[model samples]
Target: MQPLSSVQYQFPLQSLNTFGIAAHAHAYLRVTNTEQLIGVYADAHWRALPRLVLGGGSNVLLTGDFSGLVLHLALEGKQVVGGNETHHFVRAAAGENWHAFVQWTLAQGLGGLENLSLIPGTVGASPIQNIGAYGLEIKDVLHCVTVFDPRDGITRTMNAAACGFAYRDSVFKREAGRDLVILDVTFALPRSWQPNLRYAELAQAVAEQGYAVPTAQQVADTVIAIRRRKLPDPAVIGNAGSFFKNPVVSRAQCAALLERFPALVHHAQPDGSEKLAAGWLIDQCGWKGRNLGAAGVYPKQALVLVNNGGATGAEVVALAQAIQADVMAKYGVALEAEPVFV
Candidate 1:
């Protein structure tokens, strides 16, 4: 067993988080294996303190220094465990980089995760947020999630149905499953590969690129190109990708809004609900390229909030609040931030 003495005090976290907020943890442990998790939870002194399980740190905003024990999940590995008639089963550790994992799957001739290419964070965080992009969500390909429960000191596997996935939400984010730490995720990629070009932009881009019948790798490449043109790389400029979820509203509400704002951008869900484009709402509120303090809305994509330079978590939160307030005032629709504020 690794000793608790491996834990460090007041660990700096500016580089860990994509937002680049200068925050520190009271105690930090770089967990390279499951034994580290068990060790931390078994110790009474460590267990008494609040805990924050961190992955690639792309999906979190550190508003201030965390007083809890930061368990930085660095576990890594991925492989094709098995395959059936219709799908190929692949398993990846929670700490594996998401985009790299998706690329690895494609490199192995798998197809289901192509549309989700270029998404940030780790595989473990994928199920928690049900991360989606272009036209695919993690729930669409996730077969099962392995989680460790500190309460019982037991590891268990839960299927997709048990995850309770909705738009950018899962049981992992709720009270019932919050205490369970993710270990790994297994994805059932289709054996009979097909390109998922459901989004018009992706389809159009593929067409423009002269790929009438695109392969999974080609589709992934296109998605990657599109993302690079719109989103800022965290290494160059700090950001948490899309800052808000596209708010879903009832059909009638959509119709009413459409009547008033004919140019409103929305998509009709299969469930008869309307999903409005959060970027469009924020843009209409006249927030594009606007800055409050060191935080600013990305001029190219209003859905993204960027750190102009050395932005504090409070500055980002304040900017998000202002955008939310503006959208609510003009469109009567509330915008919800996507990142977990820690």
Candidate 2:
């Protein structure tokens, strides 16, 4: 096996993760190209160790130092892979910054990704969470994803249907995807664009701004403006955006909750389930702006859990547990965290 490139030992991770958790990987490797990835796999030393693929670090929390190999996918590039008169197909490397890629698509006059504007993390991480915002999710635009299988040391593409997408989840988040590493993703965007104004806040903003027929750019800008107001910038504060998944309940459960709190924020899913606003539940339980040790719920958005400087991962986990228990006890709804705790 050839010597692998960009390898390091005992890498500091505070700057890498958005939460600013001070943790270290036993060993780290940044694979810039497919060849480097292949070489790493060819080495028995690396092949035998457990591996974790890290992208932009926006959607993960470090519970403690990682004991195995951490592969930082630095591969980067994008291109118009294919297209039709009605749609355009574009492919982007896994390491591409998600927000920048969205902006780039907008610059190219592509329409599908606008609703997902300003989301943190990388293209690789998007599919795993089926990341969504302002009424649009990644599953809507994703055409296919390219993956590298460590077991076989081969690359392959899986179409959208094979992704097994659900709310904030996909096969990549489940057992089926453990052996696969995301390499790049292709998106199918409509050329004949229609802005998604299904989200209430975005719709109100666009209406108040007097955009009767909003263009793709206008919609993107509006969503960005709304997110800026509600979600804290990770750069200014240590946080993973939206710490909890909005719990989905049955219609009967929704009716029961409505009996007690008529003004509860919720949306009816097509499958007859109702999705509750996690932030609202947390706030109603009086956890907003509250802290357990060094971790605190963000005062502006109750869904976010923040590191109030020098906080440990255990503290964050404990704070999340407290919030979960309170919400469960009060509303009988379990608030599952969005970020993956490593």
Candidate 3:
């Protein structure tokens, strides 16, 4: 981590994370190329390089100083590398800003990424979490991801099925995914269009906007508006967007809940599974806007855990544990976190 101004010392990571939690890194690196990463990885200090990969830093909550090297991806580019019967292949660098890339795709007349507008983070981090918002997930648009294997020190690409995409998760996030450092990602976006209006709020926006059959860009605008209404702009207030993934349960488990709370809301999947509204459950449990120490649930959205200043990572983790334990005990359903804890 020496002889490199690209690497900084005692860097405050508060501005990096959306939640704006003040923290520090023993050392930090802004890797703009694979060669740069390999050079650093080959150092004899490899055994001691406290490594952390970063993109937009939106979906993370920084509770404390990371006693390691945080490598912030700064490489950026976008292009169309392939095509298919109806969909065209659009490729983006790992460090490319996600929303900017989505807007670019819309400008190029691509359709699939529109619903993902205004989502924070980078293209590299998107696949690992299988990020979803407004009824659409990254898996639907992913063709495959090209990654540099840190273990074997090689490059490879894995297809969608191999990603093992599930609700807000993928194999990349699994034990294997951690070994893979994302270099770039390729998405399959349809050239011809069929706008997805399956999301209730989106449809309502279409109706309210008087768009009989909204164009792809129009859909994106409406979705952006709705998201702004729900999720706080990280610039204005510290936040990590939604802090928990929706609890996916078996049909039988969902049936049990429905029997108890007839007005319970859920979205059914084709695989005979159902996704419970996690925000609803949190609110029903009366955790919304309730502060514990310095960490608390967002007032408007329960699933979003926010820092009200002076909160430590331990405090945040404690609050999350309380919420998880309460839900498990009350409804027999477990809520999982979306942020990857280091």
Candidate 4:
């Protein structure tokens, strides 16, 4: 195997991410297949190399130029397995664009991924954080993930039960970060999926239009429209959709906060904790549309931290820290950043 020292890197990741934070990786690996991945990790130069796996670069903020190889997953493959119209099985490569895949599935009349339309990131990274939007999460439709485990250098398959998916979190985001390199993801999307009209925004939009049973395409379109209105196009503006995950707190804390504010916005979770809307808290604290240095909170989305023009990663991180501190000081809620920072 050739040394990774000769491997190429397209440096200065300024425009790769939604938030165009200027950062650079000393080494870059674009692994297009399982064999390439093995070669990448086996290379002596890359073996001890500090590395970062980059996909579409949608949900991350690089604080500075990495001094190691940045492995970019560019693998792409998609297919259908078994099952009739009622249920369908599909597999997608990690490098596949997430929004494009959702659109393609909708074109195929697939219903499961419609509600999560327009989310950014790659197929491989989707299971990393279990990306969720609208009223659906990736875990709802996920069957298994094909991962290249670094522990013993073997490929392993994991199901949802082993993924440890929670609200915007999974094992990949926790202690499993560098342990696995997601190869492909398989999902069991149902054709006869009934519309989930639970989220208030979606419900209101449907009721206002007086639609009783909306089709999967309609759901995809609606969700896309809503997201478009809230999130700035990464091509137009630099941002990582939501800067922080919604904070889930103990029921007791929710009760205490609701009693104090009387109109505190909170979602009841099946778990014992109450999900606090991070946006609402940020908005309440007047972080919405607030700008500091080159970083700013998106005007329409208080939860999103935006790069007005050429914000440094450190600048964005500082703003996030300020917002976190403010929310914690005011509401006793700690805001956790969504982007995976190395």
* Best of the candidates, lDDT: 1
Candidate 4 Cα deviation (angstroms), residue 204? 1.7
Question: Per-residue lDDT tens digits of candidate 2, residues 1-342?
Answer: 654657888998888888888999988988778877788787998888777788988888999999878889888998888888888999999999999999998898888899999999999899999999988998999999999987789999999999999999999989888668899999999988898888888899999999999989999899889889988888988999999999999999999999999999999989999999999999999999998888899999999999888888899999999989999999999989998899
**Per TM-score, what order, best first?**
1, 2, 4, 3
The lDDT for every candidate, in the order shown, is: 0.93, 0.90, 0.85, 0.84
Tell me how far the alpha carbon of residue 157 in candidate 3 is from the true structure, in angstroms, after superposition: 2.1
Model 3 scores a TM of 0.95
TM-score for candidate 4, please give it.
Answer: 0.95
TM-score, each model?
Answer: 0.98, 0.97, 0.95, 0.95
Tell me the spans in candidate 4 whose CA falls farther than 4 Å from its real position. Answer: 4-6, 84-86
Which pairs clash in the backbone of model 1? none
For TM-score, the strongest prediction is 1
TM-score of 1: 0.98
Quality of model 3 by C-alpha lDDT: 0.85
What lDDT score goes with residue 166 in model 3? Answer: 85
Task: Give the better candidate number (1 or 2) by lDDT.
Answer: 1
lDDT (Cα) of model 2: 0.90
